[model samples]
Target chain A: MSTVTLHKVCKTFGEGKLAVHALRDIDLEVGNGDFVCLSGPSGSGKTTLLNMIGGLDRPTSGEITVANQRVDQMDKGELAEIRLRNIGFVFQAYNLIPVLSARENVEFVMQLQGIPPEIRHQKSKEILAEVGLNGMEDRKPAELSGGQQQRVAVARALVSEPALILADEPTANLDSVTAEKLVELLRHLNDEHGITFVISTHDKMVMGHARRLLKMHDGKIIDDIQQR
Target chain B: MGIVFHLAWRNLWRNRRRTWLTAGAIAFSTILLVLWVPIQFGAYEIMINASLAVFPGHAQIQRPGYQEKPKIRNAIDNAETLAKKLRASNQFVGVATRAQGFALLSSGTRSYGAQVVGVEPVFESGTSSIPGLVKKGRYLSGIDAQEMVIGAALARNLKIKIGDEVTLIGGGKDGSVAAAILPVVGIFESGSNELDRFFSEIPLHTFQNIFSMGHSAHAIAIVGKTVEEQDSLLTALRQETKDRNDIVILGWEQLVPGLKEGIQVDKVSGFIFYGILIAVVVFSILNTFLMSVLERTREFGLMLALGSRPKRIAMLMMLESTLLTLMGLIIGMTIGSALVYWVHIVGFAYPGMEDLAQQYNMPGLSRLYPQLDLFNFLIGPGSIFIATNIVAWIPVLRIRKLEPVEAMRTI
Candidate 1:
């Protein structure tokens, strides 16, 4: 079964003569456990497409199905539920809540899901360790390095064990070594846990690690390539 | 929920100076209100007690229509028996029967019209502060003594002194001439110009015989231990006289309507000042929370994208304000209560207040003891708490309108 499907999705910002079409006629599908990468230059609608798939933005026209639920038709509350229960997000900025410690950041989603504290603690610890962030559980985002903060974000995303992960330029702020390590971590999680990933990136390292690559130009996908 | 609380608490301290400044404003306002409210109330209490003490005790029982139009014929029949019943109850500190009439008094050429109240000396001594306030000679000696205690102003106006004779002439209850030639045995200075200039007291038996009001008096004045006890005492008085339609029970507010109205007007002005104070603090709270919200736009967007609801975000912001308000209230009330308690023990008086009070016939306000009751203690801090949360909602409402995509782009 497919983890996500988009048919004729289009997104526009503003209105009238000033309108900017951010996405146009996007059609795609990612099967369960597939590792897919969306690569493009600036203004290529890669992030907008990722936002659409994650239920963060609504398409001006078209249908988006995530985990078999029609995302485009859901209300804001339903969209939040869909994001909470079925999808995880990793942002380009390593958007860990600045006030929360690393472990608390990892446990935020579980807490929102009303998971018990003991179990949440246990799961957060294991996930932080998997992301190679052990012994750094109590450091706030400000106290951590860029790569460490990114790992905490990764741990936060993967700890909830959602069916799909939408990453928007996850390696944008990392050095080559750290970016390679992050891509490897994402690949490991996708391969070991059978979690599907749809990553939007300009990094060759991240794109090379994906099993399939989709390239986009202005606001439309120009090529779909299978690497492995 | 616990995580949200933790997050909110940490967020509040992100700008330590701003948080402290906001909380300090709240604390300062709380302290001002906490201190001012009880003082105002204490002043009101003093005013009520002082006015009541001058003549109209905490309450009174008079014949129907006597309060509005007190005529010599509008007397409560067997008033002493009712006073005896009221005095028998432990609810009252003092109860005394009195007959009052408008009489023309003359002392060899100087003449003035005054209200003459005839009272039982011993009972009047217990019920009225006038007995203790007599500046010369003494209060009346007997229930039938041909003696009078006139006010200092009246004594001055009539050019009479103790041991001098004054003639009183008035219309009797039976339409005959009520006339008396009495010696002034005491002179009292009540401080009130009206009472001092136009009021005098004589023995009840003399008043009854001269006015032809046998077994009757104008009012039965009742004094309770404290002004707060007036309501319950008035209720009991009403219940005691429920079977009699000829008499009506009245509390101090009814007996002296102007005093109550004065207090009401003063309270409204006090509330207006307090409203301005609280509104200033509320705007400070609004500014603080709005800045916090604006600064954390990206963080909120990230949280919303991670599956937290807008309601949850709003609650988190509200929790921050609640925590801040709670901190301010705790500190403010603690310090405020301690200060008020100290003042209550030592008493508070403004400079030159005694002279000012004496000038206005309100000697009670000279030294005020602010009582920090539960209502006074909570009212100020409670208003701040409620207002802080209410004003906080203005900024928090912005969270509901935040689109994760748009908010993330805010910076």
Candidate 2:
């Protein structure tokens, strides 16, 4: 069964004499546990597509659905609900709330999901250890390295057990070794937990790790290939 | 709710310096109230006490219209019976009967207009403070003895020393001749310029005989144990005198409307000042929270994108502001209470106030001790609580309208 479906999706920014087409006629489908990478250069609409798929931004015209729910037509609040319960996002910058400790950052989504403290605490520690950052629950984002902060972000996303994780350049700021380690961790999550991931990145390493690869240019997907 | 609380509380400390500074400003306003309210109350209380002490007591009984028109003709004919009734009531310390009339005093070489008051010398100690105001010589010794207590300023104007005979000539109650030649036994300075210059006290029997008032008196001034007892005493006096159309009784408040008016004006001004003070403090809180909301735009957007509702995000900010306000209120009240209690114990005095206070009838230096209780606590800090809750919404509303996508792009 597909975790997300996109058909004839198009996005436009600005208007009149100053309009830019950010996405064009995007058609895509991702089954459960599918690890896909949207690879393209900057302004090639990969991040925009990822944002629309995550319900972080709505397409100007299209039918986009995730986890059996229509996302393109959802209001801001409904989109927020969709993102909270069904979709998880990993941004390029690893935007962890600076004031929160590692355990707090990991349990942030679960807290909003109304999980009790004891259960949320236990579940977050479990996820943090799985992300290879055990015994670092009390460390704040500022105290963590780039790779560790990204792992905390990943822990936060997976801790909620969402159906799909949309990452926009999740390894963009990390070294090659860190990037490899991160890809391996994400691959392990997909294999072990049956969670689907759709990542938008320019990194060749992410493309090399993707189960399926789609290449895009000028807002349209021009290549789709099975990687393994 | 616990998660929201945690988020809000931690967020406040994210800028610990700024939060403490904002809370401090709020606490500062509360302390201002804590200090100001008590001082005003203390000063007013002392002034009333001293002024009431300079005679007329806190309540009085007199012939009808005597308060409106002062003369020997308005004297209470049944004053002896009324004094008996008042004393029997035991609601007062004592009731001193008097028949006062306007007259002129001449000491051969000097003559001056004066307000001659008739008094019973032995009873004056318990009812009036005039006997205690003596600055020179002695108070009147007997009702039948031909002697008087005159004000120091009046003595100065007459150039008369103690033992000098002064003649008082005035119209009789029956339109007959009224005159007396009495030796000055004492000269008192009552602090009030008018009292010191124009007042003279002789025995009530002598005054009635000279003024031809028979056994009647102009007024019976009643003294209660405390000034606050006047209300109940007035009520009792009214109830006792209900059948008598020939007399009227008044409490201190009725007798001195000026004092009441002055206190009322001070209260209104105090409320205006307190309102402005708390308002500025609350807006300072509002400013802090607003800046926090603006600064954390990206984080807020991330939270919203992570599925926190827009209202939920706003609620979180409100929660943060509420925590900040509570902290300020607790800290400020604690500090204010400590300071107010110290002032209450040690008393507060200002230089030059002794001279100023001496100018009035109050007998000592002006050292004020403001009273504090639950009323002050409720009015001062409670106002802050309501103000803070209402003001906190400004920032929450601002955050409510924020777009997640736009906010994420803020920084």
Candidate 3:
């Protein structure tokens, strides 16, 4: 069974002479528990494709299916619900809510899912510990380092146990060692938890960890390579 | 929802100085409203009571057309008997019968035209301030004393001193000459130029005898214990005289001429001032929340992308505003109530207020005591809470229109 399927997906930005085609006729499928990497240069539409699959942005044309639900046809509220129930997003900026502490940031999605407090607390604690952030659960995002904040973001994304995690340059701001550690953590989660991941990155180390890689240039996918 | 509240509260303190400043503005406005509303109302109460004490007690009963025209012919027959019954009811503090006629008084060729009121001396002292305000000599001694208490201004105009005999001449109720030679027993200064210059009082029986009014008087002035009792007293008075169509009951508002209109004008002006104050505070709230929302655009986009609905984001902002307003209201009400209560107990007087009150002929109005009932206490803070929430919606509504893709790019 496929966790994500994209058919002839096209995204255009702006209009008239100023229009930029950010994604063009993209057809791809990721099997359940597949670890996929999308690799490209700056304007190669890697982030846009991730956005389309996560239901964060709508395509100018074509259909996108994630976890067997049509993503392109859903309303904003429905899209939000689909993301809540099936997809977890990790942004490059390590977008942890600044007001929330590390544990609370991880528990935020569960709270929105109406999980009970005892369970949410226990789960959040376990996830933060797994991310090696034990004893730092009470520290706010500003109190954490770059690598720690990114780990917190990853903890938040994984805590809800969604079927697919879409990471957009998740390690771009981290040093090579931290970035390698984060990729290792993602690989461990993918291997042990059977959680599918489609990561958009320019890092060779991150691309090397993926079971499959898709290379793109000028909004068009140029090559698909299966490595493991 | 509790998490949302928690989040909202935490967000409010992200910029602690800004939050405190905004809440402090709200608190200041609340304090102003809480104190000013009661004080203004207190002043109005003092003004009413002082004005009523000068003559028109809380209410009056007059022969139907007498309030408008006040001709001697339009007099209430058996007015003394009616006043005695009203006084017996124990509903009023004082009830006095009075007869009034326009008369010309002369002392050695110096003359003045004054409305000569005939009052029952014993009851008049309880019901009217004039008897207590005698600056010279004494108030009239009996119901038929043939003695007069004239205003000081009238005495100066007529060149008559106490113990001097003055001749009053007027057309009688029976179409005959109403003439009298009476001694000026007292000179009272009422502080009002109109009352002091044009008003004089003789005994009610003396007035009836001289005017050929035969057991008839113009009005029965009734004084209640407090101004708040006026309405129920008026209702009871109306019921008491319901069958007697020859008379009308008038409350102080009606009896005092422009007093009601004056209070209404003052109230509207007060509301305008308060409105300006509320507008200023509401704009401050708007500015604070708008800035908060604008600065948190990326954070909101992150939340949206994390599967939080737009309404939840809006609710978070509203909860922040609600919490801020509640904090301000509690602090303001606490401080304001203490201050108002202290002033209410000890009383408040402005500089030169006594002299000013006397100058305006409202002498008892020198000291104002604020009345802080539930209405006055909550009105100010309640308005702020509601206005803050309403103003906050301006920024909060923008969250509903936010697209995660667009909002995430705001930074």
> What lDDT tens digits, residue by residue, belong to model 2 across residues B1-411?
666777788888889899999989978888887777777777777767777677777888887677877867877886867887878878778788888988889998899999998887887766667788787899988876778889999999999999999988889999987888999999998877889999999998888888888889988888777775677778878887787888889777866778889888988998998999988998898889779988999998899889888788878877887788889888888898888889988888888776765654354446777855578666888888888888888878877777767889997
List where candidate 3 sits over 4 angstroms from the true fold.
Answer: B238-245, B354-364
Ranking by lDDT: 3, 1, 2
What's the TM-score of each model vs. the native? 0.94, 0.90, 0.97
DockQ of each: 0.87, 0.69, 0.88
Identify the CAPRI category of the predicted complex in candidate 3. high
After superposition, which runs of candidate 1 have C-alpha atoms over 4 Å from their true positions? B81-91, B235-246, B352-366
Model 2: chain A TM-score against the true structure: 0.98
What is the TM-score of model 1 when looking only at chain B?
0.93
True lDDT of residue B27, candidate 2: 84
Against the true structure, what is model 2's DockQ? 0.69
Q: What TM value does the first chain of each candidate achieve?
A: 0.98, 0.98, 0.98
RMSD of 3: 1.7
> Residues B24-143, candidate 3, lDDT per residue (tens digit)?
998899889998899989988998898898898898899877788878899888999999888888878899999989999999989889999999999997678899888899999999
